[model samples]
Target: MWRVFLCIGLLLAIWLRWRCKNRRLLEMARKIPGPPTIPLFGNALKFMCQPEEFIKVIKDLMIEYGGVFKLWIGPDLNVVVSNPDDIKLLLTNNKTSIKGPQYKYMADVLGGGILSGSGTLWRKHRKIATPNYGRRAIESYTDVFNQEVDLLLDVFNSLPKGRETDIYKYIVQSTSYTVCQTLMGLSKEETMELPHLQYLIDLSPKLYDIVFDRMTKWYLQIDPIFWLTESYTQQKIFKEKLSELSAAVIKHRYKALANSGDKLHLMNSEEDSSKNTQLSVIDRFILSDELDSKELIDETFTVFTSSQEASAKIASFFLMMMAFHPVCQEKLYSEIINVTGKDDKPVTDDDLKRMPYLEMAFKEVLRLFPIGGMLQRTINEDISISSYTIPAGSALVIPIYHIQRDPNLWNDPESFDPERFSLENTKKRPTYCYIPFSLGNMDCLGRYFGAKLVKTIVVRVLRKFKLNSLHNFKNLRTIIAISTTSLDGFHVILDSREKY
Candidate 1:
């Protein structure tokens, strides 16, 4: 009789907890229109059944319920806002600066790095990292970009002409090579030999899938329950391999500096003979006393995952866009020729600056094929947007993909016209409407670095080959892993533009 009463008490406590949580969330949900939610499961059943079609689902929701709506996974509420006005209000508000709950999934791979951390930790790391990706710092990396581009062109030259090639593969490896060398201090030879580098390249999408799976499944949000799932086991193995790889690299760099008997400093030594040599981001971290070895590994992995993945996809899409629009390609080529005067020479920083039309075309590509498909933030305090009350702790989802393509914001949103990015037209759009790198304080630090690298590679490739694609732009589909990528690899025929 006593044992039976204890069991009844335990069941009652669980029921009460669930009821209390749902009571608050349901109140917020009632204020925002959304797809019908069942009592306990909420929208999880619908989302889980069609996870791959999430972007389309969100687009549909935007149409049905208007710009702002709620998606409930059990008691947790996610208020998705596609309106620029809402996005502006949310991002600009300093209190909502913390990354949303979904980003916690990335913490296993990225740790408490700038991309995944919040509060004082994020602020401290961001301050230290900001200078490394400044205009001058990015400009200094032009030689590294050119070097990588040369290797890429050499591979293209070796390939048989008139055959359709999957250029995305080469671009991915080339961008990886560039980022590894420039940021992690990994030489070309070292990068090629690192098995984990290949593992990371292959595992990126899988890791992303794990995060997505966990995000949609309410049960997986609980640590003890998530550990029971296969994704958890896979993620554990991935984290181990990634950690080992990063730790080994960090240890090697640390040992090298120690052997030299030089005291680590916050800033790079100006008087040192090695000043001319590229100081890797890892090297900077090693020199800083504020950061530990684990922090160094996390930050380096974050850069590796973010920089190469996004840059490769963006470059691939830019090339595909150029191939489909021969008129734009010709105009771009003319600009390149005018700037460099010869296709044989590598594109310099000055040459890149002179190609305004090329820059315009690149910007347009970014507008359409933004790698950052969505940005998420957790509301730290109760907020009101457009007469709707979003209770504190609710996740805020900003659909960058939808916002950029909104017809209300852009004229003929679907057309591939580089002229849309022209200075006059760009000024006409709202401030947050064109957020390829996002907007406000939490925007991407590597915006200029990424842009420079893409432009440099595009200029070099366009100058060497006349691009042609068998794939139609209208038929192309994209998958949103961490970054948006073409589902079907970018295929193009490279005809040599060499004038012998």
Candidate 2:
């Protein structure tokens, strides 16, 4: 009887501890302002709209709550962070390394590859894959980038007069070709031979479309309900097609690697320059035998699909910017001409250094239009800031869009001005204030290659053609999806330019 009495006392102690913990967390959450919540649902209903309308909800919340706010999506508490100092603090913290629960939406598409995976899997994959994308590898791929961009221009040249081509369409294709050759180790002709190449290229964007739909609809996030919906069905179809393509690329690369000798050392300069380079992305993993069949498939999907849109959309944004502000465009043109000396001479890695105006303009474009509007991180431990303490297991919504466009961060934040990114002006802002590709621990793996690819393509295109943009910067309606984009297409008129 005495022992039984002691057990009850211990149980009572555990219950009290739990209760106290819950109260503390509640107080912390209440400190941060947010839209009013309803019981059980919380702020979930506010997000139940179309993907286009999804951006509106975020904008509305930013207007009402300012930078640091909180949202209760069911039982989950998501702290919205737009303040640059808080953003820098969280991104650098080891405890905030895990991607938030929302990353689960891409699990079907990216698998446990570097982009979607967290913890051991992510760290392991990153360790093995980092070397393959090093400086030497990216520089060697410049030839491939130049060739692909020139091919893209050839398509533009063939367009009929007054056609007003959607630059997004052709640029997406060009980007695919660049990724295939540079990273996948597949030549242009080899990628073209795949029966479903075009289908997968077109389907990639639609896959993200479905991802955004499922993400916004809170009910469909549940597996029991989601599996019954059309999205799950469509997701399966997308994966099936993606799997078939992955198999072809994998098999070809495997066979090619098998047939070759080690060739790891830099051979004499007298031989083929390619002979000195390191192995491809898949080659490194295959040689190390660190990843299984399933791991390889996931990594492939992560790298291939993610690479398609990020660079394409940025280039498309610059094209529109060029059209909207021709004076800036001419400045870019003159700089490119002065650096390269001739229209036909390929812009080398060396030439890019002298083209500060081009870099400044691209940076400004990125500032005006970040590819990712928000990034979500899961806090693993209690993090205290100047205003409040963020409890463990809560999600963090880092609003990249609001932070870059905030009135406090930039003068004339709405206007399209390349001068804003001039060396003198760029130094005045916080380092985290202008993260087009993001920065710090979870920084984009493809940033260097992506920048090189876009700059090379822009230079090549500008050398031969002048842009006449059809949209105005002030009135252009933009939306956030897997990528932030113009609600309407990037329509432009390309006129032939005088050659050097």
Candidate 3:
């Protein structure tokens, strides 16, 4: 029996090797350019450990290879396009042929929701739902945005003046509350604080890094879940618990809508009776009956999963830039003060447009430290560019982070110069190069709202307090997962500007 088992294992190994080698040859025949891959592991070893530098390395590699390059993450073939013309070819001219696929893991976590859903489903959902993030919808939500901003300020106010605190957590909590109230019509405390949601955010990237690093393509194919060994059971539990919370929220929304008569906004009710008498974004989808319960839950979960991390990272970037560049911060504060006086009613939509310096500061921060840093698409059909052919089903990524910093486009790209976005300079720069919110149809839907939220919070905080980095705040490195994060946390000293 032992001899027979050994023979079977050996046969499987030989077959796997043959399969890997054959696919490798076929991929290389396409003549795509990239850094050389090491043996069975390919470029996985070089990439897995230092994810924060992933885009940096990819940008360098693509530049060396001239515009487009092929990289092997085990058996997975990814193509990187850095040149503006090549990117436009993929993201604009052939967007349909190059659909979002690397987002599959995220889509599975979301179950064909707006961000993940493709083709007809994406069109239907995007067409109807995407409008909620429009100018009018964003205007309607200013009251909510202001309310949340005040609450965030309250949280910060409660902290001791000189004590160290995790600004990341504060930003996460603030943005989580804002998204919850805006999208799902729930308060932060009312929403499920399931640990798994956090676990999934923290663990998924680490697992990907591990699997792609340790094993060859043959090993990964044998067991995709192999990376989830005994040491990671805590993460499994967190995911399971979060899944339960998603189901519970869905069930609650369903019952409320069924029992209600008018189907008005559910959150408007100050009384228990009113709480049971309206519809939310959740209710609308549930009543549509087009999505399964699991898909609905995943969709809502996706909002929570994606929004908080990205928003928090963005908020952190906004704060870090302000903290480091006091001149920029002062200019913004003056602009905010001009519109909304101290202790005045929260900022309004009309007020947002008038604050040019604030807008400039935010734009500069986004240009420097974009939330996602890259957008990816996979080819669906063969395409030709500059006499070179790109085969079907090839993975492609747009390094927004690199492009924003490309010295050719902007003068002194590394310098935090808000004036660079001044009317004159912006017109001079390439339109596509500064796309931190992405471009084309698949751009970030909540960008307008998210920007407003960040601006409101920054104005409130900076107006009341002057932020300075702590003495030990040197070497603050970013931990890159789904988003770039300062994992050690943003430690800053706050001095109150004036008494309320």
Candidate 4:
């Protein structure tokens, strides 16, 4: 009887503590407007809906609250900022430069890799990784990009002619293969032959699904509550299995390098590779003695998760847009033909640079479906914006999806217009108005590399096929997840350019 009473007392005390925290946070946040909150829950239930529905809920909230508003996820306060001025103020502020505290939740899956890393550790990883992704390095990968694109074309050519197909389906495989080759620095044959390597790659998508689900639902953030769920059980199993596979990879690489008489790159040491671009991402990580075996695995997972999504999903979206807008397709095809000009030569970095319209069309695709969708920042100190004082420790939520689609920001925002991105029009747009790859210190490190790959695939595919859709753009719907994706596949029918 005494034990039962003690348990009840502890439960009640915990509840009261969180209630008081929420009430106190609500008091501070009252200066900023927001959706009404329920006791204990706040706006947590609002996010319990599906990912697509969750995107809509936030869009609705943005409409109701105007520029800046607060949302309470359990006792946590998140201030959603809309306009460009406020976004600049928050992002540029020293307080919010580090990855948001919210991403720490992702650390369970991502570990301390770039996605959730901060401070000295993040800086070190960035320094070593940056050289591998810079323009000179990306320029070096042109051959690999062309190779993957040609393989992608081979897949299309092998298919029966004149049939409606899901181009995104084949695009996924191609992009996945690209990530393994270019980023992981593994051969396709090796990826297929090595079960452990393939398992790690295949396991990521499933883990992302589970992680995103947990991220949206506030209760799932609670360790005790999450432990009770099936998702936790699966993650627990995955965690152990990942440990096993990662060790296997580390062992294999060490043996291969030792046998080849190649030296491992050490932390803070000068890289002696003929060119940093020639070494794959895994090579750089292995070189950086700062990262242990586990950290290597974490970084590898981070790259695969980030790279594969942007490369595949954006390629899908870009191709689908081509099918929907044939005139734009002809315009892009003409540009490609003008650049390459009937020579069976591969596209050069210079060729990619000359095609501004192609760049514009790609930008528009990202604007419609910002891959990150939302950027969250952790506030380190109090900051004043407009009439409200944003307190330190609260999270800042910048909904990129809402900003890009806000009717006031873009003329006929829903209409696909690559012309909007014309150099002349681009200069007239508000600064920071179009940030598909976020802005400021915490921006995506892989944006340039990802964009390069996306453009490369789109250009090569256009050279081989005229993309057409059986479905209209209006029929397309998106589900915002790890990456924004068309709810249904990007259904496309390819007319071989050869037939012309």
lDDT of 2: 0.79
Cα lDDT for residue 446, candidate 4? 85
Minimal lDDT window, size 10, model 1: 270-279
Cα lDDT tens digits, model 3, 165-225, are 6687777767776777676656455554643445555554454333232322234234345
Per-residue lDDT tens digits of candidate 4, residues 159-209? 888888987667767777777677666666654554454454556556766
User: In lDDT terms, how accurate is model 1?
Assistant: 0.79
Task: Give the lDDT ranking, best first.
Answer: 1, 2, 4, 3
Instruction: Flag regions of model 3 displaced more than 4 Å.
Output: 1-30, 53-56, 94-101, 187-189, 192-227, 230-235, 264-279, 471-476
Predicted candidate 1 versus true structure: per-residue lDDT over 1-500, tens digit per residue: 99999998887787678778668766666878889988667787776654458767777788888888888877668898877887788888886888888888878668878877877888777776666577766777777889999999999999987898989889888898898777677777777766587888877767887876676667778889988889888888888788877776776667667655443542545643134334566766667656876787788788787888788888989999988889998999888888887547767788887888988998888888888778788887888887598888788888887787888788998778999888898899887888888777888878887888899889999889999988777887876665777777788888889742
Candidate 4: Cα lDDT at 2: 100
Tens-digit per-residue lDDT, 1-500, candidate 2: 99999998887787567547668677778888888987556799998876667776886788888878899887678999877887788888888888888888988677867887778888888866775566778888978888888789889889875557789989989999888887778878888876577888887777887776666667977889989988788888888877788878888788877677553232223442334355677666566567888788778767777777888988998888888888988899899888886556666899998999888888887887887777788887899876778888689888777677878788888788888887788798887777766666677788888888888888888888888865577778877775788888788888888532
Error of 4 at 249 (Å): 4.2
Query: In model 4, what is the error at residue 401, expressed in angstroms?
Result: 1.3
Candidate 2, residue 343: Cα displacement in angstroms equals: 2.3
Candidate 1: clashing residue pairs, number: 0
lDDT, each prediction: 0.79, 0.79, 0.65, 0.78
Q: How accurate locally is residue 98 in candidate 4, as Cα lDDT from 0 to 100?
A: 69
